[model samples]
Target: MRRSEEQFRILVQGVTDYAIYMLDTSGHVSSWNIGAERIKGYKQHEIIGQHFSRFYTEEDLNEGLPDIALATAFRTGRYEKEGWRVRKDGTRFWANVIIDAVRNDDGELIGFAKVTRDVTERMNAQKELAKAREALFQSQKMEAIGQLTGGVAHDFNNLLMAVLGSLELLRKRISADPRALDLLDNAVEAAQRGSSLTQRMLAFARRQDLDLQTVDLPGLVDNVADLLERSIGPAITIDMRFPARLPNVTADPNQLELALLNLAVNARDAMPNGGKIVISAREATVAGGDPDMAAGRYACLSISDEGEGMDKETLDRAIEPFYTTKGVGKGTGLGLPMVHGIMKQSGGQLVLRSEPQKGTTAELWLPVAQEQEITAPVRAMEVQATPEKRALKVLAVDDDALVLMNTVAMLEELGHEVIEASSGQDALGLLEQNPDIDLVVTDQAMPRMTGTQLLGHIKERSPSLPVILVTGYSELPKDFSKVPLLSKPFMLSQLSKKLAEALSSAAAAPDEDAAEAPAS
Candidate 1:
């Protein structure tokens, strides 16, 4: 029996993975095993006779938890807990600790036997796993939202195209009666608003098809200044500052313009009493970028207003889609989020700075282009009545009956002879038989044959003939942008503009592979 007891003592002293020690009745360390010395970062001589509370954190000691732990063990015979414990070196560990009351055979309390095991690795693993799960869930949710918004926006655009085109044509035909024209104009305006909403929806989902072009910063800013001031009202003065030279940016200028307009309107609304808005542009380069942008050289366009700003919570969620603070029907809650999505889609960033009572400043960072040759965009003409309307034979093709009829009506209203087809195959057949057809305007998403495929065949047969593809979807397959494009939900004025561009391309030397497309 004595030999077995000796072996037991050696076994207890040999272990080094845990801290095994004995505390006196007063909660002072009385004995320390080899494991206790190894795990607590202390020598047996250094730790023995010290208070057991020395192994507890400063916070735990202040709360008298060390004394309570001993009292509980003496009363209940055992105490067990998992928490952060301190080592002699002042480092912390997630420890699984247990203390048992030790008593003599006579049932009198003698001391306490304490055991501690480090569990930091296991705790860290659990936390990391939870974090990963949360990230995955967030990603899946955003993807689902993207798919839903993208599909709804596509269908909505197709309908808007039909509505907008018909309204524009109707407004022109009923011009004599002022009362009738005013009512028609109202309907047209409402339809245009709907079209704008659909575009914002697509923008929020990051599914708005982009028509990227190299644009000069100063020129673009100067061009939009008049429209910007007119929209913001007379109370708010506009200030513009730009350097003589700035790098051009690659972006969809129309979309960027709309985004800036949205910001301006937001600023106007914030300052009911009126305030000055500053529009500034300069060169910028960022390295190891923040969460919203990549590292690149950019043309920084900033819009600032001295008006009401946002608080922390509001600012944090400001860019979330459909989360507006404005009253119902007052705002769609999509302006900032759409701007955010556009900046990201364009490989740039949108940074908003605001304080509760101060004001707000929005910065649009657009990536710089490396190309030297800059092509000036064709200026859009706004003419209600053309002096000389082109009277040419045109082919209009679409899968949807309403949209096809709308296109045909607009062509007829413009005094062009309309040849209509409901499918790309039908349009192709018509083109082959009618060699004198001046232009072809077709829908993109047609069954069996797409607009691009038809354009491929048409180019092979008659490469020089002008053709325009109209669609709700802006994005197309690689190298499919050669034929001129007219975006869906367009007004008669837009239709007239694209038609003129196509008609003039016959005289000018165009890109050998691709035709210019409508940009937004």
Candidate 2:
């Protein structure tokens, strides 16, 4: 019996992964092994006579957890749990613990046998795994939302195109009737507003077509100063702090201006009692510093507002589409999301920082435009009636009946002979039957085959024939950008302009690979 007891004691002392120890009836450490000394950072002599509760944290001790644990073990024969525990040096670690009741041969309780295992690394890894899962879920949710928003916006744009085009044509026909013309003008204005809304939706989906340019940031802000003043009311002040010279940024000037206005309006709305909004700009070099932004030189345009800031929860979801804190009808909730998408498409990022009782700051970071990348702005010409150019036989194609009818009307109104097809396959068949067709205008999103697919077929049959691809969003493949494009919901004059440009360019540069396509 004595030899067997000695072997058991040696076995208990040899365990290095677990802190093995024994306590007296009063919960004082009565025995300690080598494992206990190594794990707890205390010698056996230092801990053997001390109270075992010393291993508990201050919070646990205040809760009387050690007494509860011992009582539970004594009554139930064993107690097991996982929680935070403290070592001798006062550092906390996740611990898996077990306390077994020790009793004499007569079944009277004497003390407890305690065992503890450190599991801090395992707990940390579990937390990291949970975070990764949450991140993946968020990414997938956003992608689904973007896809839905883009599709709906594209369909809305087509509807707006039909409404706007038909209204313009009717207005022209009834120009002499004052009442009729006024009503038509109002209808046109409403449709134009809807068109603008769809554009914002597309922007939020990161699918809008942008007219990118190297813009002078300070100058653009200066131009909108009066507009900003009128928008935010007299109570609010617009403070601009820009240096004398700053690097130009690559962006769509109109869209960037709109994004700025949206942010400014958001800031103005935040400060209901009136406050100063500060707009500033500075140069920054990002080298793996921010996870959201790429490493490059950027012009950081910051807009800050003195208002009641958002809490962490609100700030975290600020860029989610359709999430708003404003009263009913006061906001659409797409402002921040649109700006976020625009910044991303422009090779930049939008960052927002806010704290309770302080203020909110929005940073619009844009890539600096190199000197060679800057393109001179084209001078705009006043819209006028189409010039007396030679009329050509035109093929207009669209799957939507309303859009197709409106497009045919516009083409005939411009004095071009129109032959319409409802689908790409039908258009191809028509081309085969009519070799004399001079040009083809097709909507990009269609059934059977898309506009680019039709253009490819036409290029194979007749590379010199002109083709104009019209779209509501940026759906064209990058390589096909060289093909002429006209945005949807276009006015009569815009369509006329696109037609003339396509024809003239085709004539001027016949050898350009993407300039011409076969109509027949």
Candidate 3:
């Protein structure tokens, strides 16, 4: 009998080191130990016979946590959790808790054995770490976006300045005979093409207005075959493969074609001596496949090039903006990055596969549009008209002296009287002096005042004035509904068309003076 008593004392003392205690079936504190008093800030005399739920918060009590815990322990033979627990002083600490059912040998329920440990410091540290990580991620994302926006804007402006400058020069020299006029025409055409290219860049950068459509993937590829053949040169072979019944993808058809062309150009550059390029399309259902691919029907367009492919490091950073493997002046690192941005914005994904000396394949997965979402009569590019013998007053502005002079010359050659200004402020002054200014043409980014600011001022003063804004920047501030925009690097014809359109719209407006005039 003495030996059994000694063993019981040893067992109680061993459990005292671990905050071990006992609870009745009703969840009352049937017994307490030294460890429980140490951890919970309670004395054995003070806690014994009290409800075990005193260890829980008032919120837990209202939610019947004690009853739920007991029921869980009864059903599963144990209940375990790590959370906040109340102490004797009404303070809370992070706790690791375990409650085990205590049963007699005859299988009758007696009570529960409960154990707890304070872990507040560790829990708080973990929460702080998670918050810090989230903040860092957000900061990095914003920084990356800012860098991309700036790079795109700089490149766009440079291209526009070149085209617009050239067009202006061509306009001034049109009277230099038929040969000179032909050269000017060619220069203007090239500038116009450059403007189209910039517009594509803006589209990929998600800054352009998009007219989304349900596009037949195979048909689009087929249409571009002739253009691809001419653009890629005779050294490269072009091939297309498609399944008969492929799903239509929802996208801007022109943008999609441009994306394909960009990819093809990249592929062409990869193969200096030339190689075979294959364009293929197929329907795919990606359920439980790649995590990035998602679960849905997609139109998969793949472009493969036999060229000097890239390694793992290059491939990893390939989608990053301004990252290029090509030599200086050979490429703008925006090609693939723009493709990536377009895919992301279009509810799709771009996958690239490559290996050094092996070749490269880029796959574009676009979501399939529903039948009802498909619209009739796809939007196609309209043919522009040639400039006619018409004399009109025009106002043009740019920060660069050369660009300003060239634009003035171009407007004059188109049989229009040209007024030029070097800045928005100068342009505003010009507008004030010449109320007969048929069109308000201005550059976007400049010193003193921005193009958007000038546009706002002009709208306020002369709401009926046909204002045409030109920008080399990829991004425009919100609210551009009041004016027509012409991207930089435009041809003389492009300017003419825009001016014509602005005049048309202005003429269409109901004239208050006419309405007030005696019905003539």
Candidate 4:
């Protein structure tokens, strides 16, 4: 029996991965093995007579946990848990612990056998895994929201097209009547506002068409500085901190300008007491270190404000669509989300850093453009005076009846004979019936047959015929750039310009084999 006991003691002493020890009835350390000395950083001579409660944390001791643990083990024969525990040097580690009640022949508890294993590394890994899962879930949820917003924006833009188009045409007819013109103008303004709302929504969904250009960061900020100053009001000073030689970035000049203004205005709003807003930029080389950004050289533009900053919760949700912290009517929560989408679509990322007392900094990470020099922004073609051209038969197609009617009206107003088709198939059937139809103007989002499909069929049949694709949001083919595109909710002048451009191009290039080719 003595040799068996000696072998058991030797076995217990051999374990260095776990701290194994014994406690007296009163929870005093009675026996300490080599494993206990190694894991707990204590010598057996130093710990054997010490109270086992010394191993517990201060809070645990204050709660009388040592006594409770011993009592539970005595009553239940064993107690097991995982929690934060302190080592001899007072450093905390996550520990898996077990305390088993020890008894003699009479079945009375004499002591407790305690075992503890440090599990800090395991706990930290689990925490990281949980964070990764949460991040994935958030990404999926945001993607779903973006899709829903994009769909809604598409439908809304179509409706606005009908309303705004009708109001624009009505204003031309009612220009002589001051009161009627005023009401029409008001209606037009309201419709335009709704159009703006849809544009922001589309921006957040990353579906907004961008006019890409090489933008000089310093020059763009200079151009918008006065405008931003006016928008944010006095009291706040705009400070520019661009390096003398910063590379231009590739982005839509107008959209990037708007994004900068939005971020500036956000900073202005954050500071009610009036503070300096610092706008700075630098070139940064990103390795695969950042999770949100791919490896590339980036022009990092930062807008920082000294204001009451956001808490972690607020900062976490700052880019959520339509989540505003400002007073109602003072803000639209889409500003940040819109900026976020623009950066994403521009092959960049928006990173916001904030602390509750230290204010906030919004960083716009835009990919560096190949062109070192800033190029001039392409100006929109100005609507010229009506030029003499032979009016031709035009086929107008749309799924929405109101939009079709308005489009037909606008076409007829432009002196073109209009034939309306409610769908792409109907448009094709009409083309078959009316072979003389000189041009096809079609909406892209239609039931049964999409505009791209119709364009495909038209190309297969009449390679030289010109077709103009009008859409709220484009999901066209790779060769779509060859085809003329007109965005929805356009003004009459814009439509006329597109018509002229399309017709003129078609007239100029008659022999191109693609259906996207223009007629002779």
Which candidate's lDDT is highest?
Answer: 2
The C-alpha stretches of model 4 lying farther than 4 A from their native spots are: 59-64, 74-77, 88-90, 175-177, 371-373, 381-389, 510-520
Question: In model 1, which regions exceed 4 Å deviation?
Answer: 1-27, 31-129, 175-178, 209-254, 260-317, 351-368, 371-389, 506-520
lDDT tens per residue, model 2, 168-251: 888877758788878888999899988887887789899988778998899889988898889999999989999887999999
Q: lDDT tens string, model 1, 358-424? A: 9999999999987845776543443333322759899999999999999999888778999999988
Deviation from native of the Cα of residue 483 in model 1, angstroms: 2.0
Per-residue lDDT of 272 in model 4: 91
Q: Work out the TM-score per prediction.
A: 0.76, 0.86, 0.58, 0.91
Q: Residue 208's C-alpha lDDT in candidate 4?
A: 83
lDDT of 2 at 454: 98
Which is the better candidate, 2 or 3, if ranked by TM-score? 2
TM-score of 3: 0.58
Better candidate number, 1 or 4, judged by lDDT: 4
**lDDT per residue, candidate 4, 232-316, as tens digits?**
8998998899898988898998999899999998998889989989999999999997778889999999999998889999998
Best by TM-score: 4
Q: How far is candidate 4 from the true structure (C-alpha RMSD, Å)?
A: 3.4
For each candidate in turn, give its C-alpha RMSD to the true structure in angstroms.
Answer: 6.0, 4.3, 13.8, 3.4
Evaluate residue 517 in candidate 2 and report its C-alpha lDDT on the 0 to 100 scale.
73
Clashing pairs in 1: 161-489, 482-514, 482-515
Candidate 3 lDDT, tens digit per residue, 164-272?
6665654665586888778777876766666655554554465664556888888788888898888889999988898878878888777788789889998999899
